[model samples]
Target: VGHLAVQIARARGAYVVATVSPGKLDFLRELGADEVIDYTKGDFTDKVRDIDLVLDPMGGDHAQRSLKVLRRGGVLVSLLDVGDNTRTQAGARDIRVERMSVVPDREGLVELARLIDANKLAVHVAKSFPLDQAGAAHAFLATKPIGKVVLSL
Candidate 1:
């Protein structure tokens, strides 16, 4: 997610600004974000003027609007949508738009495994029902779950 990108960017000595839900302000702060904009508060385009890069996965109009915050010499990488006429015009010459997809990689998987092994990452398992109770668990999942639900043996 963008949170991970922000962390990686900061680690590489880039001045990073991130936008997240208002409820996640504390979480973003803990992740060492320099600026945290709450998307629910107002239009991020209005306040976040001039940015170097925009990493967008949540597309539709949301991705289109984010182009407004891009500086003349900036980059916008979208994971979930295509760059329409609007994105092209907004970008112009200096702006670069890349339609990118994050593919699964062994190196990334290895790093993830290391994080899990070190306990640096936590997996939230919401429910673990017996195999015989899978139907009940599936029913519970219909309501939406915060984490993984396992059918244990």
Candidate 2:
């Protein structure tokens, strides 16, 4: 989900600093990420600072660290738990942490379709396997393939 957001941001000509899993470096580049950071190699804190926006989906400690990197008056939107109470109490204004679970509306979908039709966006389908091979799909996902994994109907 975060990866998709990065792609959309890049399509809009924004500089995207994407945090991708290992082995997805080439894929991130293909999606036009300005900088791709492998979180396993080093702490993101050492590299990013005073960021204007931080999008967090995997919460817990990541959300806490994101607050540190966010510049004052910046916004942090998390798709997980609303973080600790202290985070909101602090100076992290415009911090919106809520569980987002829904598809886009018709208007939003229309725009998305237009973007795809214009070649401004690319959706990478890693592979399609049989439904019986669900375990295989999970295994392949554990290897961190960029984009999506779909089960053949």
Candidate 3:
């Protein structure tokens, strides 16, 4: 999701800032992230500020931390939990907090397809395992792959 988001945001002309493990710094850069933070090295909030939007996949405390970087009227879109305290803090700062769930629609799919066709979007499949190797797929995912791990039928 993060990889796709980075590409989509860049394709839309956003100056994207992506945070990743040290090993993935170059990976995000290649995906068109204007700024890439090695999150394992230090706090990303310390380096980023006054942002228009933050797409947070790791919620909870991470969502709370993201609020610090958003400017007034900025938005925080979380894919996971957004605690009440985070919402209250955001409201106080005049920041909008949104929780999003993936609901695929034709319009969205078509847009994504268009992006892919234009070579503006790249899908990285780290590895694929046969359907019978579902357990192996899960284990590979647990290793924190750089891209996606798939289970093929």
Candidate 4:
């Protein structure tokens, strides 16, 4: 999820900083993340401030922590469920908080396909698990990404 975000954001001309565990730092840097934070070593909120935007796949309590890194009027878009308190506080800072879910739509799908065809975007699949081992796929995701994990039928 984050790998896709990094690629698209870079293509749009934004400098991206990826928050990742230590071992994956080099991989994310290679993917065009200008700066990589090792969450295992320190708190990103403490290390970073005045960010323009955040594409957070980590939901829940992380939403609030990410808010601290945003510049005023910046946006934090989450792919996971965030608690209500995070939304309320964002309003105070003039920051925008939105929870996003991918809706299957033909136009959007076609647009993404076009990007792929144009060579402006790509998908990186890290590992595939058998359909029966969906649990293992989920477990692999908890570790830092190589890219998307797939369920191989």
Off by over 4 Å in 3: none
Question: Tens digits of per-residue lDDT for model 3 on 1-153?
Answer: 999999999999999999999888999999999999999889999999999999999999999999999999999999997999999999999999988888999999999999999999989999999999999999999989999998888
Highest lDDT: which candidate? 3
Comparison by lDDT, 3 against 4, better one: 3
Provide the lDDT at 34 for model 1: 91
**Model 1: ten consecutive residues of lowest lDDT:** 115-124
Pairs of residues clashing in candidate 4: none
Ranking by lDDT: 3, 4, 2, 1
Model 2, position 24: C-alpha lDDT score: 82
Encode model 1's per-residue lDDT on 62-151: one tens digit a residue: 777878888887887888765577477665747787778768899978876776675444455668999999999999888655456789
lDDT of predicted model 2: 0.76
Instruction: Report each candidate's C-alpha RMSD, comma-separated, in the order given.
Output: 4.1, 2.2, 0.7, 2.3
Q: 1-153 in candidate 2: lDDT tens per residue?
A: 766787788777788888877888777777788889998999888898877788888777777777777777677677777556626643446544454565779998887888899887767788888999999999999887767899986
Tens-digit per-residue lDDT, 1-153, candidate 4: 777788778877898888997777888788789999999988999988899998888887898899999999999999887888999999999999888888889997887787788776788888989999999889898985677888987
lDDT of each: 0.75, 0.76, 0.95, 0.86
C-alpha lDDT of candidate 1 relative to the true structure: 0.75
Q: What lDDT score is found at residue 90 in candidate 3?
A: 97
Descending-TM-score candidate ranking:
3, 2, 4, 1
Which residue runs does candidate 2 get wrong by more than 4 Å?
Answer: 89-99
Q: What clash pairs does model 3 have?
A: none
